[model samples]
Target: MVNRFKDPSAHLEIADLFAEHDRSSLPIELGVSRRTLFRYRDLYVHLIETDEELMPNLNAARQDPHFQKINERLGHLLDRYDSKWTEMEDSRAEAFYDWVPEHRR
Candidate 1:
């Protein structure tokens, strides 16, 4: 079942999974790759910021009985990327962008 939200990009992957009656399995159950799932979560976060209508659905997702399990799984997946990002940043002391603005200069 299609969720009734207006964002087409999230309609299938994110929204439908969060819908009240869609009956689709959780993202992990669907064999969604970790990177793809992260992309979906990022898209969902953007939608939550820009589209207030999604808030209710997001809240529902948060309150789901499986929320804790899902959260743990996502967190575990993110830990690898987080560790890599930290390591990369620590490896370089150079500022990523070092241009001084005209006024500051």
Candidate 2:
């Protein structure tokens, strides 16, 4: 029975359907026992988490085009700010060194 659902999408769809329907009637509709349905659901979630092909689909937020654009823009902004931060730190260090007395050095 498990072998029949080799495709990750099928596994996910059936599992989601079972989740939405009454647990007692699920076996009647799916032609499998409740325990088997639970097992399949667990298997499907595991595949979604670990399988390379299905893993990307699990991240709903990252799948959004708007979110992707925002993420890219934020990355660029961080890169620009990081360079300025590094320059500021370097200048502060130089100023600290110059302020130190020769005797203290």
Candidate 3:
């Protein structure tokens, strides 16, 4: 499914959050430097090591196919949020530009 997420960054950050499971199957698509992805992977492993609660949730959520659907919907809404952000950016002017020193140009 096309990710509907608002922030593309979420694709990575969130995927990493779910990585306690093998959710690496889904992949975190947020644009990342290879180094950052590796770092997040390390962080995920650390979280899994320290937290007992996350392990079961990972198992439970993975078994539920519905969680995949939830991920899709979450991505979709995030896309909408991105769209709104674009719209807002398009509508903007330098509201404070008038306060600038002309000589600063």
Candidate 4:
């Protein structure tokens, strides 16, 4: 019999697995790559941020220990990139101005 948990289309379920387990081990458990796990997380965050109908679920996720751990890991990754992003902003100001209208700049 085919295992339902191994369903390839179960993106959300895989995301929940990532949230509840050690991220390093989840890829092996789910039989997917770390990159796939990251994509699931990005999609999950997009849903939480943009899907108004999911607010209740989002609130529950926020309270979940695994969710919190995933969130913290993402936060740290963003923090690590923030400095480089700021430097890019400084270096790319001319390019940004060239691309953006004066009113929007």
Model 3 stretches astray by more than 4 angstroms:
23-105
Per-residue alpha-carbon lDDT of candidate 4 for residues 1-105, written as tens digits (9 for 90 to 100): 001222335556555645566455432433333332323322222211121333344444566666567756544333322244432123221213326578996
Listed in order, each prediction's TM-score against the native is 0.27, 0.21, 0.23, 0.29
Top candidate, metric TM-score: 4
Return the TM-score for candidate 4, rounded to 2 decimals. Answer: 0.29
1-105: candidate 2 lDDT, tens digit per residue: 112233434544554443544244322433333333323422322111111332234244455554455445433322221244532122221113336578997
Supply candidate 2's per-residue lDDT for 30: 31
Angstrom error of the Cα, residue 26, model 3: value is: 12
Q: Would you give me the overall lDDT of model 4?
A: 0.38
For candidate 3, lDDT tens digit of each residue in 1-105?
A: 111434444556555544442444422222111212222311211112211323344445554665566555444434432344543233222334345578986
The lowest-lDDT stretch of 10 consecutive residues in candidate 4 is 42-51
Q: How accurate locally, in lDDT, is each candidate?
A: 0.36, 0.35, 0.37, 0.38
How many residue pairs clash in all the candidates, one count each?
0, 0, 9, 0
Candidate 4 segments exceeding 4 Å error: 1-52, 79-105
Clashing pairs in 2: none
Q: What is the alpha-carbon lDDT for the whole of candidate 3?
A: 0.37
